[model samples]
Target chain A: MARNPIRDEIAIVGLGSTGFYRDSGGRSAKALACDASIRAIRDAGFEPGDIDGIVGAAEPGGPNPNEMSAALGLPQVTHFSSPMPVAVFALVDAMNAIFSGSCSTVLLYFAYTRLPWNSRSAAEDPFRRHHTLGVMPAPESVNAAAAYAAWASRYIHEYDARREDFGRVALNARAGAARNPLAVMKTPLSMEGYLQARMIREPLCLLDMDIPVDGADAFVLTRTECAREKTRNPVVVHAATTGLVGTNDEDQLPSLRRHGQHVVVESLRAKSDLWLEDMDIFFPYDGFSIITLGWIENFGWCPPGGAGRFLEEHWDPEAGCVMIDGRIPLNPHGGSLSEGATRGSGHIREAVMQLRGDAGERQVAGARNALIGCGGFFFNSQGAILRRL
Target chain B: MSEDVDDAALIERFPYVRIDHDSKHFYRGWLDERLLFNRCDACERFHHPPKPVCPSCWCASLTPTEVSGRGVIHLAMFLHQGPPAPGVDYAMAAHPVVAVELEEQEGLRFTSTVIGCPREAIRIGLPVELGWVERFGAPFPVFRPVEGS
Candidate 1:
């Protein structure tokens, strides 16, 4: 089957975020969503009533798209969907809504509270009965952190990678966060501090994982002509694709190697045509540090077994370095690990920020091109390449 | 089933592990007492929580082999919180948890509680040994540092 081109297509006219924080005061998820939506609408030269479609990124305890549509008094929303983790799937849904003529102007929004709950616990609400429980049942062995840790163990053993290599990524993120005022962890992280930090999962310290935060982000999407008229710096979506390489079953683990080899790398290489080295900036999902390592190799940035060495040699914040060759910047907005968690929406927001040139102090110089990646439940992955238009 | 024992005590001593068909294959079931893990021949890598195939090689040629129960404590943490199941208490420090990397099982790591010691004594890089607790009518491996080793 011929691949669909999501190129030079739906332009993001305006982007707004509530500036992630550990707490959202007493605001409900809907209120947070509305605040971000309002910012995005006004930024795009539109009013609340101008939006015709409502889309949400499915969060554990957040407002539904339909609920948001109703709450915002949009009269009638022609399209709605919650693509969890936001970026790619949300973009796909938004584009479909625009293309199908269901809605010309779409509001893509997401919000959540930071409750410090494990992802493996049973659903606290009745709404999640149909969806799989985020937490594992008791007396059962594995949790999400442990599952990812098991993968980290495999990566280290197979490749002889060092634990310190993972630290480098975290340190780089913290440094990036220091430059980003919106980043939650503004203090510089020393190697001594990182090494001494308590472990959350095997081979993954607390620093290695993304900190959950209560936050919301929104984006305004419209046709190219409308976007140009709406905003001064419209970031065109050059190409966007979401991939589901494996099932949620036990069989998926063994298939990860092949999936990483054939499904992820091969397909991304074909679609983007821009080598990992050619990209100017990267916002690969850092839900876990190992995931970043997995992507470094999967995206063909380096050889499969060479990610550790690449990270070790190239990750130097003091020298202003990036993972890709020739100083291609990475995660300037401190990424998920350093920035307060916007789920994966932070990646999309950062891309928009880079293109809009409003990134302020943390801006990557001459960042005309950016790449963003987001992962979902059951190993679903998505990638987007954006260019400032 | 004893009436004398309180429900908390009864549930506390009862070892439990989630053993689906997938977990059964991952932690190679051996006569309901022993557990084994498989290693992929092509990549020369050991699979933790065993698997029927090599993750790296795509080859189904995997062999189940018994690993030395001994390993280094790569990283360890005491999880104060657990799944909101019953009989869990915040007072019992040992109820938290422990994770270790097996020396023999390259890249293979497991999460288990530190038995026979206070949670405060658990430290990173402590040598630990595998111990089994019966749960759901099967023995599952967990870690405890070797005594006087």
Candidate 2:
């Protein structure tokens, strides 16, 4: 029988993670990444020397992309970019490389550590070195926060969203964390405990957010036919895309115009020909809990005001949430809230794990169709949908 | 002697003109606290973070409009890390960062803070009134959730 060309195409054959850690045990970012990559290559039943193409998510204070290429001792790299939402970008880059015949096998890697030795004290640091090290200074300056606060104040006035909703998101994640061994905040969170947490920014409390975590994860991508030769089962890359509308300039859509239209959701729906209901698992980026609500609404799971209700209804354990439907699991690996942020790589690694059917105890049964979304700064966003062929 | 005095004074000052992108000739000189925004006649849209040009129409035909000083709480988060300099006490109670939706503007959203109350009381969807504090030669806008509303 002649095979369907698209059905049996590019596939992810191997995956590895250094687990999620609050600290890296004193290893440099490259060292941590190397550890994960080596394991991934071996997991794919290939040797370290077998990889021809390498890609990575950009990390602050980590090895540069060129340096990683030199360290890996690859003959040449077909493609690379440190785009925000790194994991998806890395996968997209690898796909392009394979299609263009640049390299058949690719290694994608990421790592970070938050141990005190690995962590820098914010107060003692002069000139805020870590903040300045990234592509741009951290956007948490008083001016920027003030700008966001102004917007938050307006959102309160218009949409009638309440603090309880934000609290529910954090509490739910915290509660979910208690069940997962990988979560940093594994302690059970009470409403009173959440309310008592010191306020950082008005209307936003410490418990209402995720802390930066240190860890590493990697994956190997190759042509589906070649991948089938290596692994028992291969997850196919059904589709991948990234979107950026306006430049970083403040004037493009400004605050008013940008709020109503969600470009990321619109773009993904157009490209995939799948509705929110079609996805078996959702890995929407939760850089901020409020952002998750935005994703839920934007993805058309519910209308604008429907996110709070959706969470309240689906979060019940005894009732057996209908949203997941035994197939449509939402972040069973605890997501960024529980798994720690490997930058955007965390979400990608989770998707890969589910597709490979190796997500272990947290695995969703027969999760054939999966969706992942990543958003950056003020409007840069991307998404990819994958399937097990 | 008079010539020397005149030169000294002139060196310390220079003539300058403030350019306006929108026809909203609104300016504050730090006397009274007044909240204002710009409305575009072409698109019939209002803008916060008050810019000279209408964001929607990109036209200079913007007119100054006074706001009701009331808004709805949209979304809120307490960011512990990555705050910029000029740090006051660690807790920013709706002072530096908060998200708000205006009561008057249908879809306008602005990120600011609410002040004049304990930080713990700020709730979502709370009705808030605009407040201001002048510092470093500008009036910074903050919000205070309306009491007993």
Candidate 3:
């Protein structure tokens, strides 16, 4: 809480992303990153040379900051890094660079191709490998689904939550995506369909998982004053923080197993002036339905293990929940479940769009503030509070 | 499912032990038909999946202690499908993966499969007992429903 100087000091002035798809075979991850960067810079009313800093969300085999800078033909990039795989970590880095007077404008982006099922990238997860006791990991352990399934199963046990409860989260995501043109899964997801879907892991149906789509999303962050000059709707960074507290050192897994939202959000709440009620939209990272549930509890939106009842009573797949629309919308951009997994950028961009009033069909009316949650599966937690200025 | 190669190849690809400095003793416990966890000599806290240093007290001194291997299923999932990967072809339809909170420790849990019971019968909080199964020529820890409990 000491010296919270970065609050409202930085703003997102521009945003751009490649069209989401199941498999964008023609483009490499670098190409997607470059394209998104170019469009985002242009959207911010600047060219490649105008960007003095760059931060990239870590992607497997994706372009680093230097590669992206070279590809974008940027004349100078004083601050450049792509060290972390977590998306929110990268965004926070960009905000820090601007806050520290290290750079004026920062380009932040994440890009990746949906590797083929037979591809090695599927087993490239460092967490699974590390947790596997240095032995060959079970195929289930190799995929993120296993980790989520572990969490979901634990959630179900502790809360007596049902698959139907988690199903609602997926149902709402698909419903939101049906309205989003950039979303990959457009078809309606019903409870019946969700229940009938093939189980990827016990407690986790295929619908409960995210589609690894090939795409890239970019955002332009600058000083609040400069952002206002660049664009009429500059989304102010209300609060941003990242840390590994209560997470394992080796695997970076949450120390509490199925809990991390409190650790991340509590730190964020300490730094921000807003409460759960002040936000217009909630994009608690939907890497898993149970994760979103954790965020719901950890943020005091509902009590711990009460997310099922809260969601069942609050969320409606048809008209969109009054909780999401009237009170606060959750993942209004269809989230990672339906929206292609642009890491957390898709969530961040959707929050950005909602705050800017540019979210055509999914816009939260008179939106002012948005809360974005990132990184729980990796045990690390990152959060951001954005407000429309 | 076994067409690609043999059981050995499949098990090697999806190993149960990484055989690190901290975990070698833990896997050795499996070979001895015992479920072992790292017990911090300083704080007396139990660490699952074997860590070199105690997570609670940050003490490097630890010992692998055997447990009764009786646990309650903290959570359970049935993997009926899998991702498309050459190494992942070993997943059988309707495989039950359970996170069992060992009775020895309050929150100590590990990812293991539940066998000897119908996959549908596996539920969270179900009492389970560790049962060793030969996987890749080594004793791999698996769980089964503890009857009458």
Candidate 4:
């Protein structure tokens, strides 16, 4: 195993969210980002002057690191960067900056907004229309989002997986959302409702994909030494990693059994002193239900093509969600499906809350460890283990 | 052979595609109704969606080689709603898109919509041969069910 000196070295001291929404009610993405960042700083028991580093995910319409720092009136910032989204990239960047002493305190932020391509109302709005796809793409390509559906077809054919398997993932997310006031789609969903959902991309329907919304999540990170000195028991990053394989092309991906998710699982396992048996909560990304299944199987929660059956066996009908072996709850925060796509920021935020015992009604009793499998299977796959000490 | 086509004319031909220097040859092949993939001369392996160097051996000696455009469908999806494209009517029918695992090389695949076949027949493992259709007055590569397969 490669050395992981940084394991449990950094702690997330503060967390803030603008509470996801379908529309920001006229608030721009920059405005949402500033709102969340300010709250995060305050939650950390620090003022804007305490923040010396800024790392912002380069979300489509989100603000930059400097913009967030400036908007929040941070006095000075020694390190600032705009990493590509899905949360952990910025997390890793912030952690490295803190460890390397580029900055003592870092405010990592992510903001999302409904853009013209994804939302019709956003398209009609004059401000959002400027965010254009400079070059139109023919429908023949399976490059990005379309690849999930294309591969979901393969996943079904190869494993004889039914629509119900994907449905369960949606059902679980919806159930969690009902308890999560921050979520947008709180209406309880049944298996029948999911099966009959509108088929935007066949084999994967509207419920299979993440709901786009305007919101923001931000966090304050500092050295573990500082965190322990400030708080009685602060949650820390036990291990964090982003992974990719050589065959990253959506269509060219060798098969479901292998991809970035597998790499992430392997890397996290190597770095982490904690394992699934020690995990108190699980946050598998539900950007696409198929992606969640990929994490389930790739993380060795079950064998290949076994997530569908495993989820059924471990399903907590009372909770209306998957409670693994009647203990661990998957994505207690409603997740991207119902919680509005924070591009894994929602997952990270929820993990932080659960570890800090601040998850309100969704909190697991005495939660201590959180295993988050973030991003999709191809290029963006990431995983993290957060622990409270 | 395609050097005569200026960049402006090339972009005009494929207005929807963002063609850079590396992929110009591949898209240029589409204008001639020929599909091309970058084949590394050293290892003779094929890669798609065009990369500058061969992933296998890191050799920049690449050729935009044309294959038989014959393959089996490895991944398939239908779009009930999607981006606007010519000759596609999502309201009337679900448009099909497929990624075919080309026989020339393992895992070397090209993605396109299948035509001249019932939607039911468009599925994984379906044998297909490359075909062409016009989109915005330019050749668009497509797939069709291979005869007797």
Candidate 5:
């Protein structure tokens, strides 16, 4: 596959987010989007009228481009879209629009008005379908926690991984969250707390699930040269690729450690010149703890099923095994697991901050290159490599 | 009974269906106590959760055939707060759901609940056979552990 020269051609100049809350009572999704977008515009030193492209998850309660344009008063929106399901699709589309010269100075963000899973209205929705373990849509069961529980069960059965191993995943994220001022979860989560956490679905305790948060995160993307002139630091978008390996069959979608080829990593490598080990920070999607384990293994940080062992032996909030600095980090902003759910938008924002040396106390020291892997299911994988210029 | 009356009740019983021109037959088969799956005439491959065209061969010439209803539980979950089922209150009922890969093909997977087995007994690789049960006015296929399995 010929690599598009658009690699590293664009830069992210601004990142903004609302304070992630357990519940923003009566706050409409559009209001959250507006708050995040305006903050991003100012952070980029641009006005709403300067935004020429709009991209995000604009459905259910989110505002469409025209509505958002009217609300934010964007003078023009020549390129606009709201891709379905996966959050990474919006970011990738924004990058392509700029690459194709369709528009410049794009705004990309995500917001959600989450309803409780067991609420009368939420459970009774006819369209509430849950894809179990990435395949086999369970019409009778729309609780996503159940689907993840099944995946965790299979992972435990096949790999003999203990529950404590899963606890380590949650514990690590909480440790990272302690340093993040914007993280919704602040209290330290102990192994005992994780083990005794209420079981929403067997094998997936309450701590294992991503908390439903009401907030929005937005990013501003501009051409690399324009970004340098406008901002003191520009995080170059080295490469962003989407839809690496699709889940077409049940056998292809298991949450257990996959053997043989890791097509997602291969596709990511094909898009950029950076090797996996050179990254100063790793931000894999962590909507569920098990998904993070899969990424840790797939990213070649450790051998298959070695994530449990890796965390036990090498991973620490202050020290890590991957680099000479001893502080190699993942999810410096605490991730969706702790910082609250911005889908993968929070992951992208944090990566940019780390690269700019603007992450404050949680910042990885002297960080130059960062890799952000998005998407947690086998149905698709999206990722990008960002480097400071 | 008139077909229209029966269909109306089925629609009320299971409102979760995406019934359209292509998938109406699958629901109709369920009403007749038949669990139908689409088998592509060209590729001889079976498809679950019926689609208009075979994904592999893109052939619209497909036949709805009843499966053996025998398979092993690939994975199962015991939900403390399950999705709402007909006649069951959301707060009271906890469901044990299973994903069975049918014996007809390696990856022909379907979602159903396993009956007659304790939640503790449900585990990966447990053999199960399909059994029909009525929810509201609709008959749905559920699975149970095979005798002595």
Candidate 6:
């Protein structure tokens, strides 16, 4: 393995979320962040003074760690940073800081608000009018969100894949979202409905992409020893990592076979003692359905191009989700696709909830471990495995 | 003409893209209707979207060399809706975008729209060659289907 001495040492003692909404009723990203942060601090059985480390995701229009400390009035902080978004960067940062004793407890927060470009409501809101992308991107380039569609086309060509393969991912998420109150998209999705949705980017339709919504998710991480005192069944991070390749440029990426996700799988597999067989829940990020397929294939659940078939073979029509080997459920909390794109925070938070046996109706019976694959092919590919202590 | 173009003038030419010192040569090439990518002066390797130093050899010396811009389409997508561009009418049809793998090196590619081709005809593995279209009154590199391919 990869010398994961920090394994199982850091525990996510508390988690809080603002649920998710297509609109936050004119709430700013900072407001959403503060709501989640306060709940997480209280959930951890501590006041603001007990928090000595603050790690906030540097999401677009998000409050920075220093700003959060000022707003929440955290008495003092020894470690603080604003890591780039997609969730696991802040997660790994906070976990490492706790293990290294930079701070005993860290408030990790992710606040997401739809930018003007993506959401019409956000664009019309006068408060959000100041945010700009600076340089206007040409419609022709394969960058950011467009890259997934570009790559999905390549995937079909290389593997003879079908849109049906991608649809099942959406179908699964929608099914789960019907039961998850935190999800913004609760309408059950069918493969036919997926095909009929408006084509935002060809090969990937509106349903194939995650919905942009205003929300925040926060976590309180502390030493496992500290967590054991308050909660007997605390969720501990067994392994967490972020991965990248040198040629990460969207158009210049090597191929569909290799990219950031591949590196994350290699790193996570080495660091983790638990593998697929031991997992009770799977949370492959559905930022784009193509990403979920990448995670399924790259994680070695199936061959390079077999995620679609793997999902089909293991699909549970009764539950309307994929039940791997008639047991493990994929993204029981609906993931980013239906759960309103909390980046990967929704995935991590759901994992912790499932491990704590607090997922209510979505809870997996006797759940012990959860595996999460976050982000996508180019950059921000990350993975985490959480275990009940 | 490209050499005469200064950083400020180049920035004005390609207003849609963010250009810095390292990528200035790339946009300068666009003014003269040429496609340039950074080449490691030491290892004689090529890379695109211009980086400060050679990623292959970590060599400091590099040159923005022009290429034939001939390659096969590696990836393709159509945008039913996207940002506003002068010639692109998404309502008329879904705009097509493609990443053409340059023949100079494996896995090295440039992304742009393909011209002189119907929507249905554009596909991965189709042969394409460099073409230019004026955008904001400056040459913008694009791809067109190779004749008889």
TM-score per model (chain B): 0.70, 0.64, 0.79, 0.97, 0.87, 0.98
Best by DockQ: 6
- Candidate 1 structure quality by residue, lDDT tens digits, A15-95: 778877765565667788888888888888887777888889888678898888878778766777888664567887898
Fnat values, one per model, are 0.10, 0.27, 0.54, 0.94, 0.34, 0.97
Better of 1 and 5 by lDDT: 5
Runs in model 5 lying further than 4 Å from the true structure: A116-145, A231-233, A244-262, A317-325, B1-10, B87-94
Evaluate candidate 2 and give its CAPRI docking class based on DockQ. Answer: incorrect
lDDT of 5 by residue, A1-389 (tens): 54758888899998888868876755777898889988998999998778899998753456777777788888788999888645667888888999899998899878765653523343344333231222223434424345567777778877888987788778877777788877899887778888888777777777887777778888899899898786656788888776534333333353354421256666778888886668888887888887777778888888877778877776554432222235567776777788887677888888888898888888788998988777665554677889997
CAPRI-style grade of the A/B interface in model 3: acceptable
Q: Candidate 5 chain A, which ten residues in sequence have the lowest lDDT sum?
A: A128-137
Instruction: Give residue A157's error in model 6 in angstroms.
Output: 0.6
Better of 1 and 2 by TM-score: 1
lDDT of 2 by residue, A302-371 (tens): 7776667777666656522224443465655556665676656767767777777767765677777788
Instruction: Itemize residue pairs with steric clashes in candidate 1.
Output: A120-A135, A120-A136, A121-A135, B26-B49, B26-B50, B128-B145
Error of 2 at A234 (Å): 1.2
Q: Which scores higher on TM-score, 3 or 4? A: 4
**Stronger candidate by lDDT (5 vs 6):** 6
Over 4 Å off in model 4, which ranges? none
Whose lDDT is greatest here? 6
Per-residue error (Å), model 1, residue B102: 17
Model 2 bad stretches (over 4 Å): A1-8, A113-157, A175-182, A245-261, A319-327, B1-87, B91-94, B98-149
- Cα-based lDDT at residue A256, candidate 3: 35
- Listed in order, the DockQ scores are 0.11, 0.18, 0.35, 0.91, 0.36, 0.94
List the global CA lDDT of all models: 0.67, 0.60, 0.74, 0.91, 0.74, 0.92
Residues B99-148, model 3: lDDT tens digits: 77778767677667787887567887789998887765666678899988
